[model samples]
Target: MRYERADLMTGMVQEGLQALVDGRHGDPFSILGRHQYGDLTVVRVLLPGALSVAVIESETGKVMAELEPIHEAGIFAGLVGSPVPYKLRIEWPDAIQETEDPYSYPPLLGELDLHLISQGTHYELGRTLGAIPMEIDGVDGVRFSVWAPNAQRVSVVGDFNAWDGRRNPMRLRAQAGIWELFIPRLTHGERYKFELLDAHGNLLPQRADPVARSSEASPSTASIIASSKPFRWNDADWLASQAKDRTREGAMSVYEVHLGSWVRIAEEGNRSLDWVELSQRLVPYVKKLGFTHIEMLPIMEHPFGGSWGYQPLGLFAPTGRHGTPEDFAYFIDRCHEEGIGVILDWVPAHFPTDVWGLARFDGTALYEHADPREGFHKDWNTLIYNLGRNEVKGFLIASALEWLEHFHVDALRVDAVASMLYRDYSRNEGEWIPNQYGGRENLESVEFFKHLNSIIHDRCPHAFTVAEESTAWPGVTNSVENGGLGFDFKWNMGWMHDTLHYVSDDPVYRKYEHGSMTFGMIYAYSERFMLPISHDEVVHGKGSLLGKMPGDAWQKLANLRAYYGFMWGHPGKKLLFMGCEIGQETEWNHDGSVVWDLLDRPEHAGIQFLIRDLNQIYAKEPALQFSDLHAEGFQWAVADDAENSVYGMLRTSEDRSSHMLVMSNMTPVPRYGYRVGVPDEGRWEVVLNTDASIYGGTNFGQMDAWAHRSPEHGKPFSVALDLPALSTVFLRWRG
Candidate 1:
């Protein structure tokens, strides 16, 4: 009986050694770690280059037992009297290294964490997955975890293991699809990637941690172990004062910026400003410009700088190109301290096909769909997320929550929402798959948006979401309980298109396109809109907003100022791209800095000053902001005077006491006696005149005027004022 048992043990050791050498061990912990057999504890280890190995007491330096090589491949095993805390003393050809056995520790992930992850409700996946630094069983180490259900074996490989896949094969927590291993002495800043083998035993590419908090810079796609040191935020007051619902009935003028190109140091080889530099330069500038918020382009980690961060690889990591993850948090905190909200441009529509990214993760269609018709984004050559999968939805939703919770981001502007909502977006008839209901809409994406928005709103009451949806999707801003998309605001793309087209035409032909100026009012109150002249409008040969305007340099500047004035007074929150305020003459160059030198010219400075004043006035007066989302806030005093290229409208406060009259003259021909109707007979003072001499205009507007009791345009009062050519005027009534 003793001889038979010895033979069985020998056979078990040989089989384990072969499995380890082949890297086919699904549960490395079961065979390699210390295990009790009868009255003795069997210690086993697989150190590829080790000459010899010894088991020693973890507390004391006493040698417990020496392990004998059972196979030529450095498989060491020995029988100790008892199982206790111990470390492996490995001797290479010349040097010796002592480290705690990784397999001795139990599973690091709790059952609850696994359950939450499986159900797609793990809001704190960032802290649970990835390489998390923690002290487990009084041993300081990093717990590496990854989701690779289809992988036959997954191992954590890095400098610690000489980047060898066989050194640290993880223990698979079966049905949950998570593989985790706690490596002792692994601390913060250590770079690592998961080396995965496909189900067919074929080695796949090394993939970065999907939930990594920090990552190596582009070109080196390994994820780094980040310390979750508590950040000292000084924006409590800013957060406390924010309204639970921030989208409606408040002044929201967002200054959209691309961080890399906003300001670059030309003297330093034209390098982009770091996060600290941006906080110092950008925060004060946005505040001084009177913008309530600064909407940044995507700062998530991506391999290509030219994609402008829209194609992100690391969903949880801020791009290391600018600074570390903490640096980004500091930037947002600084913005909040200065009473400016920071809205991140989040891209959940598609992701690039970078090898180390989410594409074909685990050698299968894990994060994305397998079928190209349902999975591919043809326009960008990217992959669409498999939103139908609960785990994928949890991954995305957790990403959104991480920004708002960990980084204190005030809002998220979901990019390319139109693409996500439709299955046939940028696809022909046969190129797309219909949903179970056979509809053109992507039902999974719709469910994702609802789930994402509901959780974000419920958890972070002060944080809101804006949709960059170009379609006329109804109920975008309605509540989720009301069967809507549950976004706080939707980008007014139709308004932007119509208005830009109108301004691009020459003044002589402007009368023929007068409907463009009045067309937006038809759906102005549709879905709590945000009038966005975003970065998309200025790039890709579309030209800068200034370049898109008709006529020579002077008229172009004047038209831009007038257009801004009209936009500010329109019934929607405002979002002007960076450089539009200064009238960037050329198209936006993502590689270069904004044309800051243009401020040296009077015309450019005038445009900047006009935007600043517009923001200030829009914020100060309730009539311009109080009822911005309601049709009751606006009235067309003169909707049909297209022959003279004149448009007039009145903005009124909720209380009906304060009122502002806005008039625009699209032509270069000034109107002497432009009679605009007003609600009451009062002393009407010109609050802002875009064509004033101070703004490099012809100074064609009244400084002070009185509205007569005589009725005009079906109103009780009328004010006759000299309207400037290619300008807008704002008159506040003081009864």
Candidate 2:
């Protein structure tokens, strides 16, 4: 009986050694670490391609024992006298190295972390799961963790281990399906990836870290270990005053930018400016142009440059194409220093179908859906996230917070929210799924949005959210408590399409489409709106904003200037894409920069000057800035003047302390004496004229007009003035 028991122990030991060598061991810590069987303390280690390994007493600096090559695949084992603090002294073909054994340390995460991770409420998921630099028992190293619940085995493969999976397989913390490993002496800037085997032991492609804070530039997909040092921010005063200044009652003029295409260094290799150069150039340009904020096309890491940051895979990582994470922080700091806000375009809708990314992570539909109809975004050929899973929704929310709180971003303009809200978005009747109650809404995504928005508002009250929702979904900007999506603003897609269509027609036929110009006022106040001329209107076979106008070069400039005057006078916060301000004749190409050369010509320069003046007037005038939302802010003066193609209105301040008269002539023929209604019977001084010679117009408009006490267009006062051909003007009552 004694002989049989000894034989059983030997067999068990050999089986474990073979599994370790094969890289198929499920419990690596159990088999490859110091374990006591009665009296003897056995130590096992894996030093792949090493000639030999010795156990050194850490405290005494003495050689404890030597390990034998139990398996030819570099699995070494021996009795180390007693269980003492020790390090592995490895002699390889290249050199000798000494390091603390990784398996000796305890698990990194505590019970609270496990609970939060399981419930998908971990706001610091980025800090917890990714490669975090830390010290364990006075030994500095990187603690690598990943979520691959379905993976049978996971390993941290990098240069330290000679890129061998068998060198440092991670230990599974089975409770949350998280795998972790502490590689002693690993430091910042080390590149690594997770190698995994599926449940059936089938090898899978290595995955880039989903929570990586920094990554390699495109054409390479490894995650770089970021520095653990805290970045010192110089925007304290800006942050303290931010919440008070950024109210819904204040003006918000966003200048949307695709950083990769904004200003290419043409003299060089046609490369885009880095974060430092962007700060030195873009900030002053926006400040000079009088824009309140700059909204970026998603700066998150993506494999494809052509996606323009819409299909992102690295949610936590800033793209490495520009610079380090610290460089990004510096750019934002510079913006705040200049009193300009930053809004990032965030995409939580879908991700590209890259096999080595989050798609089929762990050899299962882990992050995305399994069914084709439910999971696939056929319109873009992407994969939809499985928000039904708590972890997935939590991951997205965590990513958003990482940007808003950690990166000091002022707001997040969530992209493609309409796609996530509806189950049948861009799908035929049979090619979609329904909710539990047989509705078209994606219920899980709805819940996720409410939760995400509520949490952001609760945690970061200074920051806000915006939605790029094109559908007529009700209460998009309403609070979640009020049965809405809880966004601070919604892009007015309807207004953009209708007005652009109206202006694109020749002045000879603009009267027929005049209704399109006035149609927005009917439903303008349904939600907190932003009149956005975004990147979508300038790409994909669509022409540039300048190209959209139908007329001669001179008339097109006149028409565009007039349109800018009307847009500022309209009742909504504003957002305009980059090249639209300069009147780039060509469509926006992601490969090229905004046509900065156009500013040399008077025609394009005039449009730029018009936009600059419009922004300044919009900021200085309380009537234009403060009254964008309330119903009493705007009143129609001449809504039904389609025959001569003219429109007029009055904008009142929030407290009724100020007022501005805005009038537009859509035709090329000037009206000698166009009578318009006014609220005050006195001298109405012309504040700005889009047709003025400085704006490259026909130089025809009245300098001022006197309002008489006579009812016209239902106003108690009336005024008559010479209106310019294809021009818009702003007037103030000099009472």
Error of 2 at 343 (Å): 0.8
Deviation of model 1 at 41, angstroms: 0.6
lDDT by residue (634-712, candidate 2, tens digit) is 8887889899999997898887878899999988889988898888888998989999888787677887899999888
TM, every model: 0.98, 0.98
How far does residue 407 in candidate 2 sit from its true spot (Å)? 0.2
Error of 1 at 244 (Å): 4.1
lDDT of 1 by residue, 14-133 (tens): 676688878887778877888776666778888988999999999996899898887777678887657889999999998999989998998778899999999999999899999989
Residue 207, candidate 2: Cα error in Å is 0.6
Off by over 4 Å in 2: 1-11
Error of 2 at 572 (Å): 0.9
